[model samples]
Target chain A: MLKEVTAATFENEVLQSDKPVLVDFNADWCGPCQMLKPTLDKLAEELDNVKVVSVNIDNEDEIAYKYNVSSIPCLVMFEGGAEVRRSVGLKPRPELIKFING
Target chain B: MYDIIIIGAGPAGMTAAIYARRASKSVLVLEALTYGGQIINTPDIENYPVAAHISGFEFATKVYEQAEALGAEFVFEKAVGITDSGTCKKVKTTENEYECKAVIIATGSANRKLGIEGEDGLVGRGVSYCATCDGAFYRGKTVAVAGGGNTALEDALYLADLAEKVYIVHRRDSFRGDETTVNTLKQRSNVEFVYNSNVTKLIADKRLTAIEVTDKLTGETREIPVDGLFVAIGRVPENRGFAQLITLDDAGYISAGEDCLTNVPGIFAAGDGRTKDVRQLVTAASDGAVAATAAVRFVASLE
Candidate 1:
């Protein structure tokens, strides 16, 4: 499981974080999001350069809307309080790692 | 080194793991993502014999657990390439490479997309390929599904209960899916069928607002206001990485027969990635059994 972030803590937890954060924009009903949970957990446990967190679109529609997140399991990498890259759908681990590292 | 290395953890690959492990050959299944492949997005599976009325996720979990209980090691890694050395084969991945006596390539297919303008850009905003995964976001909104296959029909049917209205657009007059399912859709009050048409353009600003559909017979076009567009056209096999090592058809599917034998010896292809007429869950399982059995024989002959 990933650290859940809401509209209240989005700034300090993600934008102002010291290290790069991989934010997973997801929802409870999205099957792909649930399917990606284990992989995200693995990444959280293994990787050191980045922190993995998730925001449920259902609870924080404002944040989801602000980021133009229309898809579930959307991965956005944040650095220096700015969005660096975003991947829309479920992808292979190597590709996800590349999206975060590259 | 292992006796068999299976690329992919979909039904075919997992089933191959089960069979190979049962035969007492050390087995390993490498999956790029989680297990279940495209089947995970499925809501319910009714067509598979004996296992009636089970969700796709449950079925996948059952198979995965069975393989794991049978002592098949699973590694979540993306396989990049394969090297065949007659008796010993190497499976290269994004993380590590492992040696195996035989290999089974069962990487399944992915959802096909409609290459219209704004289609790729608006994914999640209003355009979605998977209804089961993304349909909940469009509750009480008007949506359109494009395709005449079972997948499209099923997506439209599934969305009819949630969305305010559903428009099922197909290029052909008749559907290639089961007639019973078509009739079921006909009985729905919120479902409408648009035949002989194709979705040519997506009308959007920040999100999807409508779609431009063209009549194939008349060349006339109409823009339909829809909150979402669900594309269930079909699927294309994921075999680009192995096109150089093995044989692939024009559509990029591994060239293989029902026996699952690839062009290279001691390496086999199974599941939706392989070139075959049928690509059902049962057939993929059958291919796994056949491929594993053949792989066991090949390894035995080498010894």
Candidate 2:
């Protein structure tokens, strides 16, 4: 099941995960965000060892602002509550896994 | 070892090379064709900020020279595939193979063709695709635009400023374009919206003379006398080579992270090939810079 994450639960769902958590911060109005969703979901299913969650930045502006997310559909990967990798805009799963493993 | 290997020598790839080289990373750019990508085919580019009006070749030359001056090394080769074998990624070309710590894919998109008769034959002579680049050429001339989408409508509106008459031809009676564009075109005396019509053939011997448009409803064929024909149907991402290595959307565009990272680690895609809402050159360049920076950090992490 795809876990829906908000700013309120971002800390609990992603920041505290034992495995590397990939957060897809997105919004509905963003066209690129919509295009990147299916890929992210597939990646989450394929890479079960890595925790994948999504956060709607539109619903949670504070978290987006805290992360300095000026653009929607930003991906921030956290390991042990620290941001190990962060990227903005649309990206492929191979590159995301590279960041996680690099 | 090079920090990033950027594929395609387009605006995005060049801009990424500039940034990546500036960031103290050794950058290698691989190009299948000549540098500049699709922008080379454009006749004139006006929207590129500083330059008011410049030919496509001139603008591309400036970028090419700038990237070269910045210590970026360019290699001419066609990239076939990439393999991520846990140690280092291997980029395969027809002639040779290259290994790099990280990769940045800046391959741009290609315009979708209408596939009508004479469309391919009269490509440069009297037929054109990009309005921003080809509009000024038809100053006070008559031109016909095919398709009713936003890109087509926008091209019609832009052509209205330069052409004596602009015809907006569509297959359907109703257009999917915005209300503002439709309203503006309707208000313009020079612009005419031709509904339920499709171009059966582009008629031109040496140059574009006219187009054979057939009324879909009435089944009547009529020839519209025009000097130029601009096709603004749509575009398709040219991501065939790496589709198997990375995830692609239904439209064959690379699925990228917000930062332009692909499904594989240390391999990122940017610009028109990657799924983006906007495919403008400025946005493509921005994506390139972002992907390069991310690649830099990723390469650093390899150690």
Q: Candidate 2: list runs displaced more than 4 Å.
A: A1-102, B38-63, B136-141, B176-178, B214-222
Quote the lDDT for B249 in model 1.
Answer: 90
lDDT of 1 by residue, B1-303 (tens): 899999999999999999999999999999988888777777678989997787777788899999999999999899999988888899999889999999999999988989877777788788888888787777898999999998898888889988999999999999779899899999999999999999999999878888999999999999999989999899988888888889999988998999899999999999999888888989999999999999999888888
Please give the range of 10 consecutive residues that has the lowest summed lDDT in model 2 chain B.
B117-126
lDDT of 2 by residue, B75-107 (tens): 878788888875488888777888888988888
Each candidate's TM vs. the true structure? 0.83, 0.65
RMSD to true structure for each model, in Å: 3.5, 22.4
The stretch of ten residues in a row with the least summed lDDT in candidate 1 chain A is: A27-36
- List fnat per candidate, in order: 0.52, 0.00
True contacts kept of 2: 0.00
